[model samples]
Target chain A: MSSPLLEIKGLKKYFLRQQAFWQKWTGKKEYIYAVDGVSFSVNKGETVGLVGESGCGKSTLGRTILRLYEPTAGEIYFDGEKINDLRGDELLQLRRRMQIIFQDPFASLNPRQTVEKIIGLPLKIQGMKGRELSERIDELLEQVGLARVHRKRFPHQFSGGQRQRVGIARALAVNPSFVVADEPVSALDVSIQAQIINLLQELQEKMGLTYLFIAHDLSVVSYVSDRIVVMYLGQVMEMGPAEEIFSSPQHPYTKALLSSIPRIGKKNPSTGRIILEGSVPSPLNPPAGCKFNTRCFIKNKPAACFHEPPPLIEGAPGHYAACHLLG
Target chain B: MAELLKIKDLQVHFFTDYGVVKAVDGIDLTLQEGEALGILGESGCGKSMTALAVMGLVPFPGRITGGEIIFAGRDLCRLTEKEMRRIRGKEIAMIFQDPLTTLNPVLKVGEQITEAIRLHHEEGDLSPASGRRGFFRFWEDRRRREMAAWKKAVEMMEKVGIPSPELRMEEYPHQFSGGMRQRAMIAIALSCNPRLLIADELTTALDVTIQAQILDLMRRIKEDFRTSILFISHDLGAISELCDRAAVMYAGKIVETGSVQEITGAPFHPYTQGILASIPRLGEKEYRIKPIPGNVPDLGDLPAGCSFFPRCPYGQAKCKTELPPLEEAGEGRQVRCFYWRQIRAQREEEGGIGGELSFAGD
Candidate 1:
């Protein structure tokens, strides 16, 4: 089989914290480990979902993969070529091939620009001009299920779902081979979310595009993804085929996350939900060994979990988890 | 259980520059003493406005145009501002989605809880001439009241499961985490042991695990305190998990009302069916999310007939020109649809909606 379309190896991104004057004089420093030692890959025309809670660094991982924020360590390969260090013209060309759809549609789109300019800006940046650019903008609008008359309307004139469609159109304007959809549907209402998700899947099939779908909602991720990666406190807890992971989640963290979802039609809901002990610990000072040990609901957690970080070991053919108990 | 709150054809209209927006159109609702009734709808569907109208806290330029909010044998719409103030926290209290904005940033968490306690219980102790004539006695009474309130605040903090209530009480809202802040908000709302609690998307801002914790706390509150809850949210999962009965609102009207089980298992209205079909079940292998077409109609300029007529998949000619009153579909179920019987019959003939949405059973 051909190699994957994109792969990441040991990716890490750390943000330095501002220090006090005394700390500076004493030569002390601090860092927030936003994304630590994460590795994953996406095959051609397939979607890989990244699921995590807030402050778990899923968004940071997405941005770091796109080189929007430079990684402090490790490698990112696009079609088997290391693109981490690509600069100047090469970086610009790579950017055209890799685009992102942001979480907040209201904040992502330019309020002042009309739909025409918003979708046309990318093509214009790529050196398209006048009639060709305007025609391309109208085509993109129609592709995303918007009317041609809406091309002249401003962002404020549209509703939430319509604004999100505009955002999706902008991301697809440059015809990127890889797209990172970051919580694209979480901001939308339930009915509207389905519309956008269907639109994304349809566009993926039509354009032969690969996606890294990131969201906290597991149900949405499970619906749209081929494989799922569960992260916590800047570390991957488990990764596997979506059905296998949902059916038999090996990692305690994954189990907790799955069961925490409130399902309808249950006579007594939350009956078997494994309520975590406390909120996620501050990412600034994560736990020593297992990132989830602070809130892990496993019985008789191995003592080594407090000191030694477990390696990601494969359980099934493609299912992998990081936990001492799994070993 | 006795009827704790009853709203009869309640209407709240906002007169704007463009037109009069009927945020909470004429609707009837009732809540028993200990029942948790959920108001389910999308944004701009007037579920929140209904809760606000019941609390007598609708913002300016929005007035209760018609109908009566009979709560505890009095019409809340007819009450004066001063009279409504007395009923707000003591009779009914509301907690919003964002705790940071709802809570005072400058005040300590403990102080906020104490202030809420003082508002309802600080009475009969302050005599007529205590402020002027008996200054010393007034000072003594003030100290006693303050001491009592502080103790009650700590009790409330402990009751809400805050760790180290004594220490955390001194910390401000900024110091607490997102989940902790919500717990503090709940403590303040329940400090007086109000009969009814209005949670307006309280868990929408929280993460999943955190939301589960809050839901657990709310369940415990319902059982221990016997507080009637009017939970308003757009999340179907959360509403079904917490509420005994639910009212599904469309535009400014409640399109359906039934037991939570009936609403999820065998819905009648097309709008309700659309909402159920739109949610992607967790364990379903195939993605069959049948999204309801079109956006929620503009409340300011609604259609001449049914507000949902523009988006209903089963819409017919009669639905376009005439409004359908919410009729009794079953013993206690209600649905606003011209052809619900036909819709239910069609679904039954086409197998069942259950097989499509079945969860991965344990």
Candidate 2:
């Protein structure tokens, strides 16, 4: 395989929770295990889909990869360089090669700023200004399928899809090699979502961009990503080729999640609905041993499931699932 | 089968200073006994209004200005506020999109269910413990009724698959997770065992796994209770699994209505066709998700003719000036397009049933 463009090793993001008065007296330590010990690599010109339910730290992992959030502890290597130790001007230089697309279009762009300024800001910050910068901003707007008429208009003036187009334009302004698209289409309408998805695909092929696409929707991820990484609580439950994970999922959680997707035209729900017994346990107090043991559906679940955290073992070629039942 | 509810020429208008916002314009629908009908539409397409209008709870500045909402031979439109209140919970129960906002945050989830139970009992006209003759009056004999209601509430909590109902009943809405809160909302709505349940995007706020659980729970509820569900959602996939029939709405109008099988299989209307095409399906190839060109029309100032004509792929010259009345296409399916037949015929010739809809790529 060609060299991996972006790599994360044992990423651990923990947020300390303030103790209540009683808890403080009792001397309790609290930390929200957002992204706990996650390791993955994204190959050049390929999309690595990071799938998880909300609060599973999919967003946090993406943000941390982009250095938006200070890593609690981990190493992030981008384009064969260890970026964990980079700071000041070095970090800013690194940022030029990595860009992020946010979920909410309503909040991501400044309401007061015009589309021109919004898209031009990145280039301007990098010292490109005047006519040269203006032409590039116009080019980006066209690239993302937004009209030049919207150049003078603020974010509020455009529709949700248009605002997202503006967001894409801004992200691409820096000519970033890797993009972390964090639920880019989640907020838009279904029809409009396809437009953005298609646009992303077109842009990817054209620019030869690499993506770490993070989204809760598996169908969307499957459509875009080459590889799929499924997260539960704060750990990677399954990682493999997108098709393999979707078709022959090894993890019980992946099975449940995939089966849970309501099919479009199937008249009498052919597959058995795997309704998990309860919600995902709070990450702060995640269950011991296997994170999924509490709601596992394996008929002959072993005693080891409750007592031992399963390592991400190879289930198939390039496929890994963290489940004791496999053993 | 008895017609449970029928809405005829129903028009809901918001008389704003900017102009009359025609939210729901001349909609006609009929729901048979034990039928789950989905009102599928994009945001602001008046699907919620159709649900809220049935429940007689359309927010202020908006009023049901025209037509009849006849339920069980009683005209809901003609019913007084007092009469509507009696029918609201006892006969028809509705749940909003956001469970947290609709539910009472401070009250225990169990208390909410019990309150729904209590309201039905207190207002039940056919109960043997009559107000005129019973020795135990409502205020005087509150404890006896509450005890019964409490038991029923726990039963409801358990029915919706909330484990340990006894323990969960005491907990507030905030204590419950997102899925749990939605389940609590469902428990409250189903507690009274109403004839019809109006679920307005009930699973929209939930996670996919939780949504699947709730859908399964609803499916079970339908079979067990034989309750008719008016399921409203923007998700075709979720609704297709649950709804027996579906009404595709656009710009406050029902463009098409048909059996869920027919609707998902061969959608007659262009908007429905576009929507189904837009969604990125599992195992579907990248070529399938072609976004319908143009935006949904503004309800405040809809076009002179068809609201969707601007974005519709099959639009013709006639669609520019005259609004096509919703007519029966075939086999109980309705379509509002002026050129559906021609479009289908041409599409067939092209041999592209699942083909792209010619997205006027920007």
What's the lDDT for candidate 2? 0.88
Model 1, B96-209: lDDT tens digits are 889999899999998999898888885653222235455488777677777778888899989999999999999999999999999999999999989999999989999998
Error of 1 at B101 (Å): 0.6
What is every candidate's C-alpha DockQ against the true complex, given to 2 decimals? 0.74, 0.53
Pairs of residues clashing in candidate 2:
none
Residue-wise C-alpha lDDT for candidate 2, range B207-304, written one tens digit per residue? 88888888998999888999999999998888988989999999999999998877877777888878877887685444568799978888989999
Please write out the lDDT profile of model 1 over residues A1-327, one tens digit for every residue. Answer: 446999999999999988888998898888999999999888998899999999999999999999999999989999888999999989989889999999999999999999998998888888899888888888899999999999989999998999999999999999999999999999999999999999999999999999999999999999999999999988999999999989999999899888888888887786778888679988889899988888887778889899998899999988999999878
Candidate 2 lDDT, A1-327, residue by residue in tens: 989999899998998898888997898899999999999899999999999888989999999999988889989999999998888989889889999999999999999898898998989888897899988988898899987788999889888999999999899999999999999999888999999999999999999999999998888998898999999988999999998887799999999998888888785673666877788899999988999988887787788888888999997899999988775
TM-score for predicted model 2 compared with the true structure: 0.95
lDDT scores of the candidates, listed in order: 0.91, 0.88
Candidate 2 runs further than 4 Å off:
A21-26, B123-140, B354-362
True contacts kept of each: 0.68, 0.71
- Rounded to one decimal, what is candidate 2's iRMSD? 6.3
Which 10-residue window in model 2 chain B sums to the lowest lDDT?
B353-362
Model 2: CAPRI class: medium
